[model samples]
Target: MATAGKAVVAQQQTNLPFAYRQYSAAELKEALRKMYLIRRFEEGAEDAYMRGLIHGTMHLSIGQEASAVGICMPLSEDDQITSTHRGHGHCIAKGADVKRMFAEFFGKTTGYCKGRGGSMHIADVAKGNLGANGIVAGGIPIAVGAALSAKKLRTGKVVVSFFGDGANNEGAFHEALNMASIWSLPVVFVCENNGYGMSTSIERSTAVRSVADRAAAYGMPGVVVDGNNFSAVAEASQAALARARRGEGPTLIESKTYRYRGHSKSDRNRYRTKEEIEDWMTNRDPIALFEAELVELGIIDQAGIEAVREAVRKEIVEGIEFAKESPMPDMADRERYVYTEAA
Candidate 1:
């Protein structure tokens, strides 16, 4: 690794376009572990996809790990989170088992959805992950419904709805936000604004300058944070979640982030330039940024960082092997879940 002072000076001199909070050493290290786990898990999934071991289309949250980890930091195991198509990181950060996640990707019986839902539909209700939605804004309403339930039941549980910038244009987003605001539902609408909603850039498709601006219309607090910065994201989420828990109502948090991979495996680079992607990856990699900060802050040396990386790598490899060795679903039960089981 480069010298600690060099990293600190370079980062300090560089002007960050948005506001972010500083992190404690312990918090930084924990965040790094989670972020690294997400990265390695995503990489494993990509490798499996490329090798033809996984079927069906998948969306990898390769560059958006920080957003997932940071947002979930303030959440409880009992607090629900609804996820979009690119939601593996959300599940991982929320304490979903990586072995089961790999099994889901590989379509094994031990998968979260029993191999039925695959990558885009994995869910663990007990872990507070409602599920990942294939539709752009499908999870929004579900999260709202969960928040409503929590309020009615007086469970003191908050719901975090994770969606992409593209989902903002959907009618579901509007309806859910409006309803949540009026009811003062315990929900946080987190928009991972990765610049583009698939092929259409935010500039071309959206009327508002920022997604956070849309919160004013719904009569709630809207915050725009540096999604690549874990500290910034965590602080923003903490505030938003606090408001939700206090019954202050929903919050719209727009996390400005970037997706390193194409929208999916099928997407080409026709919509955006290689230079733009390269710039984001080189300058704003969440993992790299956090690593440097940890070094600069004297939280962890490069060796300690490497140890975390190696551990995460080992876990991912073990998960993949476990998924491969897991059994396939019994063919006789194919007709079972299609109908509701009798009590």
Candidate 2:
């Protein structure tokens, strides 16, 4: 009788939201930590940039934390991902060291690209990050090529292509999706529809109602998720990942999220009003929403949440300090990595 009752309880637990039921308390807490790290890291970078510590402009992903962390939840380090220009969140979520990222921003030799790639081209190949592309929809075709390699090599690895809604209109986007579907490759296309491609809004640019709608033309499953909600994004990612692993082909996921910052540091945000940005920041903040869910589910308490924040604060401070103290690449070695040397 006790065994039967326990089974019933287990079944009941499965009825909860996908993330709640699928992930353990520890995993969920870790996800929360990553989200916090992403938030703080960007904030720290912004501070440094304003203080003239970093060169070149950067694209901040302040309000899109949930979408990045959630989509990466079901992925392994062996699984590859292609990132965009505004990809610090994705890099951190996929297990990047914040210190190296800061070092890159500071143009130190300790950076992932030895201080050469800076903000837009961070890549950790051993961790399966194919690097962030500067071109719109650039990573989509690269991800398909990587997936093709994985399939041909019989590596059983999956590749995820992360792009913005702006990339949906690009010709490369259509071609990549079509190729992935026709070949039945193990790849997933994730569109982070933050409502704007720079200053242009989606309604003004895209003909389709949703970015996922275009996936049908490529003959793949089109899924739209509340990208601001961590659980919803993770659930969709998990399902899509499973499908890819089964050799069933690609899935296009349109994550409906928002970005609090402008398109880049240069953007004045004149395209949108203060009221709209304020509303999203105040009410639809991804970090706050995820924290609320964690507390409600008893996965973490207020004190625990604060502890995580405190830890992340310390880490961010240490990362900035490390970047400040690290040596910059010497001028004499400027052309060292530019060309390949003969064996």
Estimate candidate 1's alpha-carbon lDDT, on a 0 to 1 scale: 0.89
**Per-model TM-score versus the true fold:** 0.93, 0.96
lDDT of each: 0.89, 0.93
Kindly report which residue stretches of model 1 are placed more than 4 angstroms away from their true locations once superposed.
1-24
Q: Listing every candidate in turn, what is its Cα RMSD in Å to the true structure after a full C-alpha superposition?
A: 5.4, 3.2
What stretches of model 2 exceed 4 Å from their correct place?
A: 1-14
Candidate 2: clashing residue pairs, number: 0
Q: Where does the lowest 10-residue lDDT sum fall in candidate 2?
A: 1-10
Per-residue lDDT tens digits of candidate 2, residues 1-343?
Answer: 1123232212333567777766667788899999999999999999999999998999999999999999999998999999999999999999999999999999999998999999999887888889998999999999999999989999989999999999999999999999999999999999999999999999999999999999999999999999999989998998999899999999999999999999999999999999999999999999999999888877889999999999999999999999999998999999888789777
Best by lDDT: 2
Clashing residue pairs in candidate 2, if any? Answer: none
Measured by TM-score, how close is model 1 to the native structure?
A: 0.93
- What lDDT would candidate 2 get against the real structure? 0.93
Instruction: List clashing residue pairs in candidate 1.
Output: none
